[model samples]
Target chain A: MARYATTPSQTVGPYLHIGLPWPDGPFAVAEGTPEGVWIRGVLYDGAGAPVPDGLIETWQADPEGRFDHPDDPRGAVARPGFRAFGRCPTDANGEYGIFTLKPGPVPGPGGTLQAPHIDVSVFARGMLHRTVTRVYFPEEAAANAADPVLSSVPEPERATLVARPAEDGYRFDIRLQGEDETVFFDV
Target chain B: MSTDPTTRPAPPAYARDAEVHPPLDYPGYRSTALRHPKRGLRLLPHLLTEVTGPLLGEDRISENDSDLTRQHDGEPQGQRIIVHGQVRDGDGRPVPHTLVEIWQANAGGRYRHTGDNWPCPLDPNFSGVGRTLTDDQGRYRFTTIRPGAYPWRNHDNAWRPAHIHFSLFGRAFTQRLVTQMYFPGDPLFFQDPMWNSIPDEKARERLVARFDYANTAPEWALAYEWDIVLRGREATVFEDEVDED
Candidate 1:
C-alpha cells in the first residue's frame, strides 16, 4: 500500500504558552479529588537554566490499568471523572505540575508487564520535535526492575526515568541536555 | 492453549522517519545547540500505554473557540483569512474529532506573549490563540487575521516569514505533532533558517498552504487550504519482530 508520509515536526517556539495551556490543564483528575497527587518538576537546559517556555503533556491509565481509548484491548475506561491526559506549561520559574492518581501496571509486548508509568511528551523552543519520555514511580521497584523498557536502557542511566518521592506524589525533573539527561524514547 | 479469536492484536507503534523530521542538533537554529540532547534516544516498545491516547472530549472547547476574530468586542486588525485543513492518517483515512490548536502573531507580527518585546505595538483585541475540534470528516477551520513577518535575532535583520504555529493530537499518543504553516510563495523562505532546516525541498513545500479561491467567502475573508497527514498504525502488527538497530 502506498502510504502518505507524515508531516515533519517543528519547534514549538518561544510563544507556546499563548496556545497550549488549558485552564484545567494540570489536573488529570478533578481538583480536590481524594488520593490525587501532584507530579511536579522543573525543566532545565544544558546551561542549567530553567526553560520557562516549555510544555509537558502526560498520558496514563487509570488506577486499574484501564485506558479511555478504544485501542486498549482490555476495553475502554468507564470512570466518570478521570481524565487520562494532562497538558501543563512551565511557569516563569520553569516549574510544572500535574494533579492525578497514580496509574497501575499496564500490559507490555511479548506478554510482559509494564511498570506503573506516565507517557510524557516534552515540547520546547529549541526542540525540532517533541521528545518522548516516561515517568516511573519510585515505589514500584520490583515492577520497574522487570519492565522491558527499563531493562533496555543502560543500567546507570535508568535512574533518570524514575521519579523521586515527594510530599504528595513524585518529582521527575527533566533535563533536555547535559549530564543526567532524561531518557528520551524513539517511539 | 488457544488464542481468543475475537480479541485482535494491538497495532504496532509508528516509528518516526528521520528523513522527514529535522534533527535536534540543527545548527541553523542556535537554541538547539545547548538544548538538544547529546545522547541518542532509546527505543520504546509499543504497548497498551503507547497505542492508547487521551480522547479530549468536546466539552473542553467552548463557543467561539474556533473563531479568533469574534473573541473580543471589535474585530482584530488585519486581512481576515479562513484557514481550513483536513487531518488524515498514513493510510489516507480521516482522523475525526481530533484537537487542532493554533497560535500566531497579530497582523503586525507582534505576539501577545510577555517575552516578545520587539518594539511592535500589541493588539488589545487579538490574543492570537485559538483551538477547535476536527469534524467527522477530519476537517478543521479557523477564522483569523493573516500574520505579518517578524524580526528575529537569529541573523542580521532576520525577519521570519509570516506563519502560524500549529499543534495537533491524532488518535494515539505516538501521533502527536507540532508544526508551522506558511503561505504559498513567501519571499522570506530563502533567509529563514527554520524553514531551510528541512533537508528535502519537496518535504518543505508541504508546510505551505494553498490559496483556495473557491472556498473564499465573497467579501468576508480569503481561504487557504492545507492537510496534515499523521503516522498511522500498521495494518498487521508483528508481535515477535525485533526492532532493527
Candidate 2:
C-alpha cells in the first residue's frame, strides 16, 4: 500500500526544444486527419511576453466522452485515427496549434457530467513545474454551467478557460502570470 | 532565512528546508508552497487520465541517434563517456520500451540553443542530443562527452553543476517524467540550488549517477549508471477491468 514519490520538477530550461520536440511530436494524431478541428493558442509569461520555448500538451476524450485508454472504464475509443492527445511546442511568436476534434462530455466528480474540456499543461523556461489548466468550449455553454471544476472558479475568472471558436477550431490563449492569468489547477 | 518549523506547512512531503534551494525566493516555485491556492482544490477525472503517448518508432532513427561521440564527422572534443541506466516503477518493476531522451551542454559548457549567448566555442560535430528506448530489462545507454559546468545569473557567482536533462515515458501520457541527472563527484553539489531543492538529503543523492569502473573501457570512455524511479500503479485492479474484453 506504499506509494512511490516521483522525482520533483525543475526548470524546463532554455534548451528544452532540442530534446522535447521530435519530428511531428506536436501532432498526437496525424495532421490533416478529417474529423478533428485544430486547437490553437499562444503561451505567455508573467510579464505578458510570449514564451517562445514553451511546450503545451493536451488530453481529451472522444466526442462520445470515451477515451482509448485502458483506464477509461467506459471502454476503448471507437475511432481509429483519433489519439485524443497532442503535444505542441510554441513558435518564436509563442503560438502553438493542434489539430483535433471537439470532445463531447465526460463524467465529473461524483455523478455530475463535466463539460467538454481539454486538460492543458504548460512547460517552459523558468517553470520549475508545469502549470495545469483546462480548455473548455464556449459552445458547450449548457454543460459548462453545471460543471464542477468550472463552478469552483469565480464567475469572472471562469472565462479564462473557455476557448473562442475560429473558422475550424477553437482558440484558447494561456497566460502564466499577470492580470487575466490562466487559472491553474492542483493535480 | 529563518524557517519556523512551527510556521512551516507540510502535507509531510515538502517539510524540508527551502532556503537551501537558491535563487532564494524563486517566483517559479512560489505557487508550490504549503499555503498555495491549488493545494486544496479537487482534481477532476479529465485531469487524471494517464493514457496516450507518442508511439515513436525506430524507423525514423538515424544511424547514430544514440551516439553523441560523433555526429557528422570526427569525434567530439572532451572526455569520452558512456551513460547507462534503467527505468523502473516504485514497485521495482521494469518499465519496458519507454522512450528516453537526453540533452546536455557540449564539453565547452555551451548548449546548442539560440538562448545560450555564453561566450563558448561550439563543436560543429556535437549537437548534444541523444534518444533511445529502454530494453526489456528497462535498460538504456548512450555515448557522449562529459558535459561542462555552466554559469547562471541566479545569484552572485552562481554556477550550475554539469547535468543532463532526461525525459522518460511511462505507459501513458500523464506518466511522462522529466528530471536531471548529475555525475557522482561533482563539486557543484553544495553550490547548486536545484540539486539541493529536495529537503531530504538522501533523496537528493538519488539524482547522482554512480561511476561504473567495469563498464568503462580502460581508456576509451568512462561509464556512469543512473536508475530512474517513476510513480507506481494506483488502483491498478480497476484499470485491469477495462481490458477484460
Candidate 3:
C-alpha cells in the first residue's frame, strides 16, 4: 500500500489579513451571547517587542463540557449560537482578542480531569510553523492542581498557562521567547 | 463490564516526526531567533478538542471567490494560469467539502497589502486573494495570474521564489495546515531560508507544484497541480480514548 506523508507547515507571513481573516472570526460564540467573555492578549517576541503580523486561533468546549464535533465520544452537542472556535489577527500593537464563554473541565488520560482550558495556535510572519499552547482559567485552582497536563509542566512555567482576570473577561499574553514565556505544547 | 480505567486506551495522537518539519529556532530564518519559544514543548494528549475542529464552508465564501482574475472589473497584469489540486489525509483518503484559501504576490512581485511597500508596481486590478471549498473528491481549482519573485531584506539582495500561500482546514484541528506552493525548478530554492528550512529533501520537494499539460486550456491559460496531505490520526478507536481522556 502506498503511504503519503503529511505536508509541512509554513508561516502565515505578513499579509495574512488578505486571505485568513473573517469579519466575525474573533467571536467563538455569537456576539451578544449572555455571559460571553473576551480573551485578549499581545504576542511578543524575545526582544519583548510586539508582533503586529501575528494571528491567533482558539478552540474549546462549551460550559457543559460538550463539543459540537462528531468525534466527541459523548456525542456531538448542537448549540444554537456556539461555534466553539475563534480566530483573530493581531492589531498594529500586536494584540489579539477572542470572545468566548469559559470552557468546562474535560476528561483526561487515566480517567483524570483536565482543568477548564482552551487550545491555542499561534502564527506569524517570521515563524516557519505555528506553535501550539493552552489557556487555563485562573480561578480553577483546585482543578488546575489535579490536572494531569498542568502537573506535568514545571512549577514556575505553569503559571504562564493560567490567564489573569481582566475587566471584560481574561487577559493571557503570549510571549514567543524571552523571560516568562508561555508554555507551548507539542500535541 | 470492565471498570478499570487502564482498560480504556488513549486515542491516537498526531504523529510528531520532528525531522519532517522545520525547527522553530532555525537561525537561517533571521526572524526565528527572537520569536521561537525558548523552552521545550510539553506533550499534549489528543483529547476531544484535538480531534475536532470548526467546519467552515459555503456560508462564508462565494462562487467567484475561487477565481482571482475575475474578482475585479479589469484583468490583472500577468500570465493567466489555472491552479488545481486534491486535499488528502496522510492515509491518502480524500478530504471533501473542506475550505482552502490562497494569497500571493502580483506579477511584479508585490503584495496588495499596505505593508508591502516594495518598489515594484502594484496591479490595480488584482487583490491576489482567492478561496473555495473542495469538491466531493477533495479537488479544488483556482484561476489566477502567475506571481513573480520578490526581493526581501532577509539577507543581502534576498529574493523569494514565485509561490502561492495555501491554508487548509481538514476534518480535525490537528489536521490544519498552512504552506507555500512553489514553481517547479525555481533557481531561488538554494538561497531561500524558507525553502531550505525543511530538513528532509523529499518533504521539501512536496511544496513544488507540477505543470500539467493535460489540464492546460489551449490558448487560454497554463495549468499546475499540487496535492496537499494533512496529518492523520492514530489507529486507535475513539471509544478507548474517550473514556481514558
lDDT of 1 by residue, B51-165 (tens): 8887776887888988999999999899999999999987778999999999999999999998999988988889999889999999999999999999999888898999999
**lDDT value, residue A108 of candidate 2:** 56
Model 3, chain A: how large is the TM-score?
A: 0.97
Q: In candidate 1, which residue pairs get closer than 3 Å at backbone N, Cα or C atoms, i.e. clash?
A: none
| Candidate 2 backbone overlaps, count | 1
lDDT of 1 by residue, A1-187 (tens): 2168778788899999898899999999999999899999999999989998899999998998888888876668768778988899998889999999999888776667789899999999988888999999999999999988887899889999999999988999999998889889987
Tens-digit lDDT string for candidate 3 (B84-136): 99999876789999999999999998999989998999999999999899999
| CA lDDT of every candidate | 0.88, 0.71, 0.88
TM-score of 2: 0.83
In model 2, pairs of residues that clash are A36-A101
Give lDDT tens digits, candidate 2, residues B35-144.
12222233433332434434444643666778898676888899899999888875457778777888999998899988898898888878999888888988999999
lDDT of prediction 2: 0.71
What is the lDDT for B127 in model 2?
91
True contacts kept of each: 0.69, 0.20, 0.62
Interface RMSD of each: 2.7, 10.0, 2.8
TM-scores of the candidates in the order shown: 0.95, 0.83, 0.95
